[model samples]
Target: MIAIYPGSFDPITLGHIDIIERGAKLFDRVIVAVLSNPSKKPLFTVDKRIEQITECTQHIANVKVDSFVGLTVEYAKLHHAGVLLRGLRVLSDFEKELQMAHTNKTLNHDIETVFLATTKEYSFLSSSIVKEIAQFGGTIDHLVSENVAQDMYSKYQNQ
Candidate 1:
């Protein structure tokens, strides 16, 4: 069945890619949906995030990249996706993710939220953490895809 993996993906990290790769194996189709939020200043634009995710996931034939601006459940409905895939990295992540899953369930009972345990290697990885490291001139080569790491370096070159 089609599954929608929704997130800001401000700059997709290796952790995010890990989840997408695993999700693709479980679902017939996996759409990496980037959320378009105007409130928070993101390192990358929605379009750029989509492009990065697309590039990183190109090897997975069943994975698609897109952006959305409204409720995630609505987006899932629009795509006729039966599952909303999410990644759980730790106990803290479980609490927040569980709450989001419950809230989404209230909005749409048909779509199920599935949580995938992040690979142990990526348990402590996140886009924010990567950006923080990059902002301070730390090596993020191991935190994100090579393309994403290059883009991050390019973006922070002038900062």
Candidate 2:
């Protein structure tokens, strides 16, 4: 079944890639969707996020990259994705993701939200954390891919 893995993906981290890779194995097709959230200012644009995710996931034939600006469930419905793949790294993530799953369920009952526990190595990883580290001149080589690390470093180069 087709699955939609939606997120802001603002400078997608290895943790996000890990979830996408794992999700790709579970679904017939996995769409890595970058959410264009206007409310919060993101370091990278939606298109940039899509490009990064595409570059990182090119090895996975079943994985496709896209961007969205509306409700996630609606996006899943548009793509006919039966599952909404989410990654949980900790207890707080569970609570937040569970709430979103319930909200999405109300929006579209046909789509199911599947939660995957993040790999142990990425349990403490996140895009924000990576950005934070890179912003303060800390090395983020371990949290993001080489290309992503370069991109992130460039963003904070003048600081």
Candidate 3:
């Protein structure tokens, strides 16, 4: 089965990679989709985010990285992916994910969302936090992949 892991992924964090690595093992194909939300101010552009994802996930076989500027369900339909992979960090994430899962299911009844609880070590890791650290000139070497850290630093410096 093909699974679509959709996220803004402003900069691909190690937590995100952990989920991708785990999710990749479950499905024949895994698509790491970078979501484009016009309402939010994302530090990284769609192209930049896609580039980071590509660089970070280059070693993962059977995994493809791409970007979508519409609803995730719509993207899933376009890719013929029947499963949506989500990683939950804690209870705080459950409610929101539950709502999204239901909404996606309503949009595409055939599409099902599978939630994977993040590993304890990565439960607190997120792109927002990584960006915040990098923005404040703090080290994010542990939060994101080396390529991601470098890209984020480059973006931060340019801004």
Candidate 4:
């Protein structure tokens, strides 16, 4: 079955990669869909985020990277995906994701939201934290891939 993993992915972190890698193994195909949200100012543009995700997940044969600008459920339906994959790193994440899952259920009963618990190593990892660290000239090599780390480092270098 095709699964859609949607997120802002301002700068794809190891935690996000963990979910994508695991999701790829469970589903026939996993599309890493980046949300083109305009409200929040993201460190990376949607196109750039997609490119970064593509570069990071190149090792996974069944993973595809894309972007969308509408309801995630609609995007999933358009892509003919039967599942909406998400990752939970903490209780706060669970609370927020659970509400989204229920809201998504109301929007489309055909699509199922599946949540994966993040590994212990990435329990505290987040894109915001990654960006913060990078913004302060701190090393983010451990949070993201080497390529992504370079991108982050370069992005923050100018500021």
The global C-alpha lDDT for each of the candidates, from Candidate 1 onward, is 0.93, 0.90, 0.91, 0.95
**TM-scores for candidates 1 onward, in order:** 0.98, 0.97, 0.96, 0.98
What is the Å distance of residue 24 in model 1 from its true position? 0.4
lDDT of 2 at 157: 96
lDDT of 2 by residue, 1-159 (tens): 999999888778889989988898899999988888889999987777788888899999999999988999999999999999999999999999999999998999898999999999999998888888898999989999888888888889965
- Cα deviation at 126, candidate 2, in Å, is 1.0
Clashes of 2: 0
After superposing candidate 1, which stretches have Cα over 4 Å from the reference? none
Q: In candidate 1, what are the lDDT values of residues 77-141, reduced to their tens digit? A: 99999999999999999999999999999999999999999999999988889999999999999
CA-only RMSD, every prediction: 0.6, 0.8, 1.0, 0.6
lDDT of 3 by residue, 83-131 (tens): 9999999898999999999999989999999999999999998888898
- lDDT (Cα) of model 3: 0.91
Query: Distance from true position, residue 62, model 2, in Å?
Result: 0.3
Q: Give the Cα-based TM-score of candidate 2 against the true structure.
A: 0.97
Residues 1-159 of candidate 4: C-alpha lDDT, one tens digit per residue? 999999999889999999999999999999999999889899899888988999999999999999999899999999999999999999999999999999999999999999999999999999999998999889899999998999988888877
Q: Which consecutive 10 residues in model 1 have the weakest lDDT in total? A: 43-52
Name the candidate, 2 or 4, with the larger TM-score value: 4
